[model samples]
Target: MSQETAEPGIEASAKTAEIEALKDTFRNVPGLAGAPMIMAPALAETFATHQHELGVRVHPDLAVKKFIAPFRGPRDAFNPSGDYGAIDTPATPIPVLPNMREYTPHELEVIVGQLRDMGVVNDPEPPRDVAHVVTD
Candidate 1:
């Protein structure tokens, strides 16, 4: 039996449409102007990039407590391995690694271009210098 898969281009387009619709919905909400829309993949990458720093800030004695026994629960209640099992996780349409090094200029341009096309951003060119602040 042959397995059927979604065409990459079509899948991407559908995701883009979904994102645009969500943006439009958010745009109409009061008091939400200028808020940034962060997708899951971007959030995951951002978490990974600054994980060490985050751990230090959140738990100063994390290194010292690293050897502590982890909490155990029923296998059905807690999955230590983080396995999704049969759950189907959709792929991110736009893969973005948010960091000083991993996020490349090309990726920035592509994202900016997409935003411009969606009328979310008006600038013809992406900003040369962007500041990212991480706080505890």
Candidate 2:
């Protein structure tokens, strides 16, 4: 006797559709423009978690570059004033990386806090108290 395999259920199809829709959404979210590699489980998980509102997987390697002249150059990379700011400053090369890892929301918050303390961003405060209390 020959046996026939069962087709996938509606639930599986629906889940697949949902995942596809999420992939589309992930593509549109800014700052997430990177190749999606299936072999990288961490990257895949991270992309899904941050972009799909799903569980987070491993943290992916996100590349970044910063101005090197100010941090490292003797104003040597590019003289914005001298060159009329026409030339772009050279950026620092990639820094040594640690084992790929994931960041919890709490860890992210801590990183953000440290960045703000380092003046990378401004602290959230009441907006200048723009409105006068106007107490008589």
TM-score for each prediction?
0.22, 0.23
lDDT of all the models against the reference? 0.43, 0.44
Please give, for residues 37-124, the per-residue lDDT of candidate 1 as tens digits. Answer: 3335444334444543343123323322111111243222122322221223442243344674566899888888898999999965
lDDT of 2 by residue, 16-127 (tens): 5555444433321223344222223344345554654554222213313212333332342123211111124465444454432577779879888998989998977875
Q: On a 0 to 100 scale, what is the lDDT of residue 19 in model 2?
A: 54
Supply candidate 2's per-residue lDDT for 22: 41
Worst 10 residues of 2 by lDDT: 77-86
Q: On a 0 to 1 TM-score scale, where does candidate 2 land against the true structure?
A: 0.23
User: Pairs clashing in candidate 2?
Assistant: none
- After superposition, candidate 1 runs with Cα above 4 Å error: 1-3, 32-136
Clashes of 1: 0
Model 1: lDDT equals 0.43
For candidate 1, the C-alpha RMSD (Å) to the true structure equals: 25.0
